[model samples]
Target: MNKFRDKLSTRNTAETGVRYEWYALQRCAATYYREFEKPKIIWGNLATRASFTYDEKDHFFINAPACMLPTSSKFILGVLNSNLISYFLKSICAERQGGFIEQKPVYISQVPIKKPTLSEEEKIIKLVNKILLLNKRINEIGDKKTSESARIEQEINKNDEQIDEIVYNLYGLNKKEIAIIKDSLMK
Candidate 1:
């Protein structure tokens, strides 16, 4: 990839004859360099259609848009990945074929990210940390079906449920509202 680094330096690559002038590759590179001082949340364009796919990496987003937040908090990702956010996206996004919705910059930028209370923020950060740890464990374990792996998987599931419930409460959703959200996602 180093060889191709200069490809986007200009509108076109002279060596490979590849053109990137059409896309904002140079702009992306500039943002990437600037984001190191203040990291941002990286997520897929189709995040709402699928799961709330996101990463905390300090890398350049090529075709994806990064949320340039003041703090590089993973709790924001925790909130974005919650079931409540997914339901909210589904409701607002325009439907495409195959039942997939385009989670473009326009739609994503409008997502209402609630500012949690101090206590709520702390709890959310803790839960997100645990979730990240369990996910790391699962990756480390690979496909091996050890008893320990099974236990870890169970714990991960439980933590996920807790996160979902916390997010719902944070959004001030009543039981009936939560039920409606679940029903919508099921379909």
Candidate 2:
């Protein structure tokens, strides 16, 4: 009987990928928390350490929201939001799909719901607009930084050439001396 049970459990365990497990967990967490009268609690899964390729037709792809957290951190958050029962169920499903189980179940429990009131929903829209503005600002800043860096680099190169010319004129160093000095200074 023990042998049978062990075989059954092992068979059950080989079923789902981390991607599916994470998708299910995210859906469940979102649904569960959205119903709360207070704040709407949001949970997310940790980012995958390894990359997996997916067919675009198989999944919905949106330009990730500016407010969304990075993938690695999101996975940890998902683990925190998940319930033990839900986690176990997901594990069983994953195993059945030939996916490996986590050594320890990781999930978040009982996060306070923070559902926004109607007025609050309006505020959230406004916040999203702000996020858009912030993204634009970030791009502009990055462009400026790149331009400044390039300008500085050009100036430095010009200055170096001038210094090399001066040194060669003053010391009458040979081509090899000049080349060695320039290479040593650059390094």
* Best-fitting candidate, scored by lDDT: 1
lDDT of 1 by residue, 1-187 (tens): 5566555456535544545544443443432355544555555555434354334565544444443343467778778777888887898888777877777667767778888988778887788788778888988999999998999989977877788898898889999999998888888
Q: Model 1, residue 58: displacement in angstroms? A: 2.5
Cα displacement (Å) at residue 146, model 1? 4.6
Q: lDDT per prediction?
A: 0.70, 0.34
Q: Estimate the TM-score of every prediction.
A: 0.71, 0.23
Off by over 4 Å in 1: 1-28, 36-38, 47-57, 62-71, 143-147
* Winning model by TM-score: 1
Cα lDDT tens digits for candidate 2, 1-187? 5545544444322333112332122333333322333322132232211111112122232333111222322222222222322333343322312333222223222222234345534443443334334444555667566665565556544543443343354345678766664454332
